[model samples]
Target: MSVYHRPVSNIWWLKRKPYILFMIRELTSVFVAGYCIFLLVLVYKLTQGADAYGNFMVALKLPSSVALHLISLAFVLYHTITWFNLTPKILVLYRGEERIHQGLVAGTFYAVWAVISFMVVWLVLGV
Candidate 1:
């Protein structure tokens, strides 16, 4: 018996807004993983000693490295915002038998994120 197979175009995902956004989100993950690996390398360099860590920091300040970091930061932000927006769909909340609004749920996540980020900045700056 022969199986029926549907032909699909290479750029099929680009045809729709949702598909394009989904593809962009998936692509952002690569940059996110790359950034994670970069952070891990930074940690490793720190463990190697002060001189190695200092050199690593110096390298990171180079124009090419700064550009790469900026690009990665943009992708990471896109990935994070998209995922947070999706949180409501993935997690349904209830407040005493009443279904909570999706916007509220997503906003809660953003609020928590902002609080944590502010705390991190405060700690890092020692202010």
Candidate 2:
């Protein structure tokens, strides 16, 4: 007996709203990873001494680089928001036999994100 295999269409994910959003979230992860690699390269350039690091910073200030960073930031933000929303489902916390509210769970994550972001900004600004 031969096994029957179902053929999947390339645009199958586009058939539904949830599927489309899920695919986009997964796609954004690539941009996030690319940004991480970009940071690693930045660190490597910094270790190469002042001139190399200065040149890297100069390139980053270009319009094309700025646009790419903005686009990546948007995707990364979406990826983060969706993941945070899903955390409540993945992690169910019980409080004295009663389950904690999903909003509170997600809100806690957002609060932590805000605090960390503030800290980073403060450090970057030397304030």
The number of the candidate with the highest TM-score is 2
Residue pairs clashing, model 2: none
Please give, for residues 36-70, the per-residue lDDT of candidate 1 as tens digits.
Answer: 99989999998999999999989987999999999
Query: What TM-score against the true fold does each predicted structure earn?
Result: 0.87, 0.90
The best candidate in terms of lDDT: 2
- Candidate lDDT scores, in order, read 0.94, 0.96
lDDT of 2 by residue, 18-123 (tens): 9999999999989999899999999999899999999999999899999999999999999989999999998999999999999999999999999999999999
The local lDDT score (0 to 100) that residue 82 gets in candidate 2 is 95
> Please, what's the RMSD in Å of model 2?
2.3
Q: Model 1, which residues run further than 4 Å from truth?
A: 1-5
TM-score of 2: 0.90
**Clash count, one per candidate:** 0, 0
